[model samples]
Target: MTGSLISPRVDYASDPARSRGRFQIEPESRTRTPFQRDRDRIIHASAFRRLKMKTQVFVAHEGDHFRTRLTHSLEVAQIARSVARTLGLDEDLAEALALAHDLGHPPFGHAGEDQLDECMEAFGGFDHNAQTLRVVTRLEQRYPTFDGLNLTFETLEGLIKHNGPVLKNGKRMQDLPQAFLDFEHLEQLDLDTYAGPEAQVAALSDDIAYNNHDIDDGLSAGLFTIEDIKDVPLVGRIFHQVQKDYPLLDRQRVISEAVRRLIGVWIEDLTAETSRRAKRLNPKSVEDVRNLNEPLVAFSEKLDAEQKELRRFLMERMYRHYKVNRKRSQAKRILKELFGLFLSEPDTLPPPWNETAQQMTKDARARVVCDYIAGMTDNYAIDEHRRLFNLDAMI
Candidate 1:
């Protein structure tokens, strides 16, 4: 109800008052903006609750301290709010996008997604972004009048196109995911253009959160040492600075300070670069932002290169560490086996899902199976696999 105290809303920011409105019109909220209402709905969604047990980079049961999807989303939302406030964008919209961005990710992180996609290859393949749209649009069945939360059009558009346009230069992309196509039939998402400025902020905020948090997780896991990353461009320099600043600081504190500083550097660069772009482009409205050839929110050229270097370091030293690969291998096996068994025996699925799969054709049944599997948490998937595959285990 209170207006943003940080700064006035910018001309290019998405305005909830002037929102394009939800697909299924509902009475307006007296206490919250449409964007804020969308954020609240996402927070209360069952899919969002399941994120608590979903993997980020580590399995849920791997360690109590490791970040899960829920914590990661929270972090992303925090960063998004901060960045949006600084940039005078709609903080609620940015925060909502951040919270909902990863709802489509399956259990066991990218490993689970990869295995599911492989299993679904004959059934149009799986894509997380498309699945995210499906989750918000068709999968979630909370509303009595609609399947999804009936989020604002702006929120839906941002959710799908946050990374950028789905279509290339007003042209349909080859091998486009079925979920996106399905949604497009119901609502035109302007798939050929970048999303609004708030969505752009949320997208970059996601990048900032994961990049920094993974460093912390990797360090905690001992996949690599601070010394190992001491040469990784901006990351390395920040760590070195932290060490120099506090010679007696413990390892954890040093990592905490370094990661904090690194995130700050990224936020500053993103804010400055975005402001520079806005000044140059002088977008008069959020529509102008969407129609721009390039994204309004971005890291400086120098920082973008450095961030890529950091990603490369993480890819080699952390994500692909032998220990992580072992987990990935096991996760892939569990998901792949689960997909195979469920597709082969729809009766294996629980209750309504089984009934739904039984009514559909093979391709449609495969998608049903995929959805059931994709909705699982890491532990749930593992347990489900055990229940199905282990003859001695009770069903």
Candidate 2:
């Protein structure tokens, strides 16, 4: 079976021009590919800069190391790069996709998202994943003639793969590609199928990163306890899974240490399983291809199921806690006041806003209203609320 299962190495999509650039930092006496260029471009974009102003689970200013979207993206990039390298896949593509994945998230974290969706319900409810793709491809206008980033097909496909790929013309990344809807296009299947190992690794790595960090953030917010987490049936299963495998179940360091061990366990299982299959079939020839012997990416299904249950636990016990509800209610009142006062009495709005609002179309005004409210940081939101309502004096 050495060569029997192998197909010829045919890349219909890896062309340099496919990524829309002629090399901004041309080879320092070398050649850089388009995907590599894409990665670098993202490393410097302003939208990426705004990530510092955005929230992950907690407010961005809470602590230096507490995760921001920027921090989360960096972590995801590191994890994705590690997995992609180990799997013999293109690391640049994985890195670029991971870095750009959350670029569309609005301010004030997901609360801002909930508000945006509620406000835009008539405009086809908001989805961060789709919005992410839009940011790089269209909405993120960094320059004239640059309403979109015009990223490579691979990067775009991965961004939209959160739910599934869209198709247009005959390509997976074309504007809602028609080929994607045909169901016969194997390569166009939603990420659940046919994604190369990098794509799969990137997906699971995101889950791993967010799950662990959300728990960390929840604790920081004084929202949950190790004891509380340990009591859940599924959470208990995870804790036990870690203790049975890891030697240093140090009580003071348990959760963070456990997260690392769990990551290693999944990586080991995935690597061993794929390597066994490759050797069993004597896949020498295919393994010679750039990324062939690289293990197919996967997480333990058991672990993934455990994570889902754990997240539900957080949602019920921490995220929906009354204190959190109070904060969100305060947030809503602030947003509603800002929206109503700014729009209803544009005369009283900040100077630039009045002009901006006057020029905004009805749909555009609604979107601007969402953006205006979403852009307010926690303290800014509160202060603006007081100032607008005359509950407090302005600066």
Separately for all candidates shown, the number of backbone clashes (residues 3 or more apart, or on different chains) is: 0, 5
Q: What is the lDDT of candidate 1?
A: 0.90
Off by over 4 Å in 2: 1-31, 61-65, 166-197, 231-252, 269-297, 342-356, 371-387, 390-395
Model 2 Cα displacement at 152 (Å)?
A: 1.8
The TM-score between candidate 2 and the true structure equals 0.72
Worst 10 residues of 1 by lDDT: 179-188
Per-residue lDDT over 1-395 for candidate 1, one digit per residue giving the tens place of the 0 to 100 score: 98664767899989989999988889999999999999999999999999999987789999889999999999999999999999999999999999999999999999988988899898889999889888998899998888988899888988888679888754565558876777844347787889999999999999999999999999999999999998899898999989999999999999999999989999999999999999999999999999998999999999999999999999998889999999999999999888888888999889999999988899999989988989999999988888889988756
Q: Each prediction's Cα lDDT score?
A: 0.90, 0.60
Which candidate should be chosen as best, given lDDT against the real structure?
A: 1
Per-residue alpha-carbon lDDT of model 2 for 174-206, expressed as tens digits? Answer: 334221222222243233333444455577667
